[model samples]
Target: MNHRMIDRNREEGHARLYRDYFSDAPTYTETHFRRRFRMRRSLFLRIEEAVTTHDNYFTQRTDVVGVRGLSSLQKVTAALRMLSYGTAGDAVDDYVRIGESTTIESLKRFVKAIVEVYGDEYLRRTNDEDVSRLLRENEQRGFPEMLGSIDCMHWKWKNCQTGWQDRSHLFEDLAESHGPKVRYTVNGYEYNMGYYLADGIYPSRTTFVKTISKPQGKKRKYFAYAQESVRKDVEEHLEFYNLDLQ
Candidate 1:
């Protein structure tokens, strides 16, 4: 087996990438960066900084033969481009000057580094403060005691269990005798359990609030619309990243 060396000129790619996005006076504006990257420039830079610090593969390094490899910017940009556009790995080669194999490898490492660096805070169980924040936000949106929106991505299986349910540790606290309690009044009726806005497919569980199948009057119709609009948060977030939400 033989390998081809294309001389991607990684240094020039890094220079162009930095000048266009990371330099003090970048060629592109923050708005453009946000539109393409699916996140604010500040957030992207923060992720880049964290990943570079966490993973040495992202840092530019010289080989034993004194040949410098791709800089952190080129590697990160390549990985982000693939994620943001859902494009093929080779699609970023011309700009990022990263080979297809290298682009794929960078993406794998970037994902791993991101998980290792930020997973604890972002992926942990929701605490009291989080529940409180969600309660406040949902209350303003006409959904008192609503925890958050819930949705599922259907997948085929050989023999799956019963219909999907909230099997996470989310409801564990609610079951505890001395756990955090949420109380709210709706239409003169007081409720204790915080619920999530789900779809019709979900079971009629007290913790899962689904919209009306056929909203009758103006009030019901409005409520249905509002609930659905709020429930699509996860879908909207997935779309922003060019991911297949379903």
Candidate 2:
């Protein structure tokens, strides 16, 4: 009874070894590969080359007994599927032909390789050119010298310290806003410049422009419409960027 059980387990483990799921044939075309991996074939191949070149762990090799390991494409595709869909490691076994533990290890190694290779170029600090470009783009959107939008989001920290829980005083500089505070002076009359649009939770600072709850005059209505529209554009851009990454 135990001998048959061991044989069955061994057969099942090798079932995915010869499946042509990752092949470039009619069954699994390049188009299907790109859709599932969320990247073009060329880009995937480029990344594979970079990863295998940078780290020997990702390189395909044969064991002492002549058993061949997974290819670079197989490992990268498994990792990319998990990253794209946030699925369990075992979920990719059928298509990528990689075991759950191996898939998870591939993901860890893939991410490490990406950060090591492209972190500096993509994660560099903004320089003068970047600042100028931001200001110019915002100026075209009726906001001169504006850097970017500012907002806070809450993140749940499971193991947060008690001392870090009640640190509202850290945001003391962002005190509640008062209505119609003068930001800058143009000739004699006061002019508000370099302001950001925020939600009602923020205090009425001259730097922050909140939507008016009730507007009686046409000018106020127009201002509210324009402000909300521009603010929506910023929100939509962020959402688009996130979706593209996913």
Best by TM-score: 1
Determine the backbone clash count of candidate 2: 5
Q: Give the TM-score of each candidate.
A: 0.64, 0.49
Model 1 C-alpha lDDT per residue in residues 151-180, reported as the tens digit of each score: 543422111122211333443433332223
Cα lDDT of model 2 by residue, 133-242, tens digit: 66677779876655455444222222122323343321332343222222555448566434567666655566566778787699889877877777767644542232
lDDT against the true structure, per candidate, is: 0.73, 0.60
RMSD of each: 6.9, 9.4
Worst 10-residue lDDT window, candidate 2: 153-162
Q: Model 2: how far is 84 from its true place, Å?
A: 1.1
How well does candidate 1 match the true structure, expressed as C-alpha RMSD?
6.9
- For candidate 2, list the clashing residue pairs, or say none: 176-203, 177-203, 177-204, 177-205, 178-204
Best by lDDT: 1
